[model samples]
Target chain A: MAAIILLGLNHNTAPVELRECIAFSEEDTELALEELHERTEFKEILLLSTCNRVELLLVTDDRETCVAEAKQFLAEHNRVPLDDVEPALYVHEGADAIRHVFRVASSLDSMMVGEPQILGQIKSAYRTATQKKTSGVILNRLLHRAFFVAKRVRSETGIGDHAVSISYAAIELGRKIFGTLEGKEVLLVGAGEMAELAVENLIRHHAGTIWVANRTFERGLELATRFGGRAIRLEEIPESLQHVDIIIGSTGATDLVITSDHVRAIMRRRKNRPLFFIDIAVPRDIDPAINRLTNCYVYDIDDLKEIIDENIEDRNREAIKGERIVEEATIRFSQWCDSLAVVPTIVALRRKMEDIIDEQIDKTLGGLKHFSETDREAFDRMKQALINKMLHDPTMFLKSNGCLGDRSLYLDVTRRMFNLDNER
Target chain B: MENLRYLIILLYLASTVSYLLYLFIQKDGFHRAGIYLLIAGVGIHSAEILYATVSSGQLPATNLYDALSIAAWAIALVFLVIQFRYKIRILGIFAAPLAAMVTILSTRLPETPIPAQNIFNSIWFIIHIVSVFIGDAALALACGVGLLYLLQEHAIKAKKRGFFYSRLPSLELLDTTGYACIVVGFTMLTIGLITGFVYAKAIWGRFWSWDPKEVWSGITWILYAVLLHERLTVGWRGRRAAIMAIVGFCVVLFTFFGVNFFMKGHHGQFTTF
Candidate 1:
């Protein structure tokens, strides 16, 4: 293969200490990328430097020479034996190298099953390398194609969607009953860690004004004011209940702070507008019985967790769909890599054949008295047409089936049929 | 055809047993067998349907009963495909019996020769059928996760690793997928309901007639729509969302088989009309 191969170590192969030993800071990564690209064998090179990995996707045809140089560079920097780290490295050549890049960019090989951060990370690495002019044709094509596949996986599957978190679900419930939470006021009751996290989530959703109410009032007041909402007394439950669209009660009251009658009375006061109630307390602060009322939605902590669970399940359900897409895109990327090999071969063959035919026809017709210029031109055109018609089937077949592992037969047949070996 | 149906039922039974065994043993063999069994069942189920179509000289889209049967099979087929693809063995813990139950119940539905007409002429029928199956499959998966969430929460409360606690995906992955299923299923169901409404307007001269099926379906749609909007816009998700998803599927179950059996609605005469 004319392509450059890469060899590198990552989290999968070695522990953190070993990885840190071979690692370079972000500044040095740009410098190393520049240095590698300047070498003759390096048509392109990019260093993917992350906490878990520091892989160099380098382009060079001389695999053994590149590995030897890279090993020397790392050993001199680390002051460690090159033999000890030899087992930690993996080499990928040609199509395998291209497939590896796609998988890395898509995050199918990630520790977290469907994490999305890797794509952005890869893009940044590609950008940094490009900025330093360390990337050439091969790496440029691979990185750009990797980004496209990553985008497709994101859109086609729910892998990146849904945080599947209890905190996120608490916020989702708040948005459900209330159409727009932009200007809506939320009354957050209690200061439990889980309850606080849910409130943090709701705040992220831009729940406009938040009021914190706790037994002590002071404990709740501190967290509330930070989010730009006021603190209310526990006794002001009824008054606060009417003003807020969401009542997230997480008090450890061991009884209901918001009862059915409290909700009924509030529903009457608010002109029967929908109220979202999430009682994220073990003792249950809001009465579950209140969910029986129309336009009044009540869900306990378990329900919120269940919502997150359901989201997780749904993502798992679509996991295969995502995998199939990633796999297909992987092969598609490899095919692109393979076709690039054929271009040069085809260019060389066409030139050599045309030269031989031109010289032979010219020499044969040179000393003929009856041979006119127009006749020779017509003969050349006929010869060229015959060459195209004869070579079309085998050339097309070889290029199309390049991935089938039987290309030698086509090359051999082409040389024998054309008898172009005699010139060399 | 009857023999093929028996084979399909046998596969269902085998899968149910394997899944139940999996709940206890958590063996890879049972998991693999469960997949094969389900695939075999679906393959036979598909062949049976194709055979029925040719032998009965009726198009698969002709009758309401056949449509429900086809819809049920579709649910099973989609779940099986995803199961085989994802190696999500825990889903079979619920999906198998649910598929078997739908298949069995579909048989109970009275079969009638489809009314002679170009019923499949309009594209609405295909849309309605497809959405029903997709929604049904989503609800099946949602119910499975919701059930697991309840069990896991129960186990967490009890501090015990019940059989379910071992097999289900992490509480996070489950809750996320459950919420997504509700969203996807709800979108499909909304399409189903809209198509039903359009089809209703074409046949009955109104978008809705306040039929029991119509009323209950509208209620189901609103409930799930609330669930989805809450998850996406407001950030309501987790075990609580899962419980709602399960509850929502109960309504879906009632919508699918119960309404035709117990409730009076326009859906009852949909085949004849």
Candidate 2:
């Protein structure tokens, strides 16, 4: 039976300094994987190295010696001392290893739980492993199952649906109001860092032409040039409102920059198209009263924070559901691994029985050739049925849960009794 | 034939249950199950109506039972089309129950016997009934979309992030869907009223009637027309549009049911119990 082993260090176990020293670059990872496959007893090897975590998944017959060798190899490859690396390294074997892989792939084990980038990183790592031909049947099946479990967790739960950051919350809220930000015009007010970040996210959503308004003309022009948008004086914001559908306000202004009166007058001219105001300023750049206007929405910094906080809670709750999916997938994959153990014994026993039956049938039929072809055909059928009936109970016994506790014991006894090993 | 009607009701009921489950559980499987069940129900209901019309050599909606059945079928059919177009599966929470309720109500009411005068054979009458029922179905969907718009809008404005915020579609989608439904409904209603006038002229020897149904249909038409006019000229959209779509549907319901049940008119004779 092959033992599944996972040896790794993650953000949770090691500090950034230690992790950086131990991490492998893409080229280094491929080289390390090849060296490990050649030098170690590991039959299948996959090395996953991301900024936050580095994990080595291996399938081997000897667990103890292979794990020690892997640790030593990691120390030598990264030029780090074995004493420093050993403290941060964690090891998982058997079903626990499977569960760990599932959890990691699904983002439950991420430093920031439910972040989506980890899955992509793991996918790329798996792609490299497959490209190098270092991953075999067990590792390929395990990684594929991990990807499947990740997808199932994504669809079945809201783990990745909520936005935990301030800028992301703005985009999320914009989506809730506009359905799709595509082709929606955006106006950036005062050129604050937060507002620029929100604009960056909006541009990614394919938001149409951006307009920048600032207190100073030069700064506004520079910011507009950076975004490939037009720069306008602060007074032009009201007139610009006619075309702009989204306004992101993050200024140092103490007073409200966009009063409800300015928006009310422009709304009719704009034909009552919906306007979304994201106020990221501390004292509030847009008026709270604007939120009450028809076809207008205003969300200030505090409101965005509240949404992010609520979403974080939602993600935490959904992560619990995700963990359950991971658990179920882990149990299923482990059962498949367990069933793999019995296959060789079953095949060897069947082959041995068939060989003995074939030898007996040939000798008996050779002597009875003088009788008739019909008699020979009847004899062949009887011998086939005898093999099936004779091997049925032992095969079932080896495969069934009745021998699950001592499955290896049953396999060993059956192999010795049939003398299956020597026949092979 | 009656067993087929009962089966349709059962299918609609199952669809309604599935949609309600999807609303609470937010599961894709329940949503898919609801859609398939609704399609089946609509399919069988269409066949039943076609069978009735073929057997009688006239439109099936000559009586109240057949009219309600056709109305329910039209609602489900229109909803299915909208669902496919918009991918707004959550709207099924409302559309399915409404379809199921109308279908069940159709079976409970006693169906009036067909009139002997053969007025139902008029092509104008058939066109009018088909157009009116389909129009009402579109209006009904608009009402459902309107309700969803208000729910999502309130959730966003209030910043509550409650049960409906994530479950419902975006406010803009709901608003746009409502607008599309109203446009289609308003157009069909206009055609229905025109054909009805033609039918009235042929049978009653006059193009205009002061009958309760006629008066109410005219009122419903004017209401939607004003809404459409304002939407085009004055930019009355979003919340106002959603509210108007809902209010127009109320007038549509009154024209459809209230006029027939409470007031006596020439149209009542066709649908009389």
- Most lDDT-accurate candidate: 2
* A90-116 per-residue lDDT for model 2 (tens digits): 999999999999999999998777899
| TM-scores of the candidates, chain A only | 0.70, 0.79
Predicted structure with the largest TM-score when compared to the true one: 2
| Model 2: CA > 4 A from native | A1-5, A27-47, A56-87, A126-145, A155-157, A328-424, B27-29, B54-57, B60-62
TM, every model: 0.49, 0.82
Residue B261 CA displacement from its true place in model 1, Å: 27
Which segments of candidate 1 are over 4 A away from where they belong? Answer: A1-25, A35-43, A51-54, A65-91, A192-201, A249-261, A279-285, A342-344, A347-424, B1-273
On residues B221-264, what C-alpha lDDT tens digit does candidate 2 reach at each position? 99999998988998889999989888989988888889989999
- Report how far residue A404 has shifted in candidate 2, in Å: 31
Q: After best superposition, candidate 1 residue A298: deviation in angstroms?
A: 3.5
> DockQ for all models, in order?
0.03, 0.75
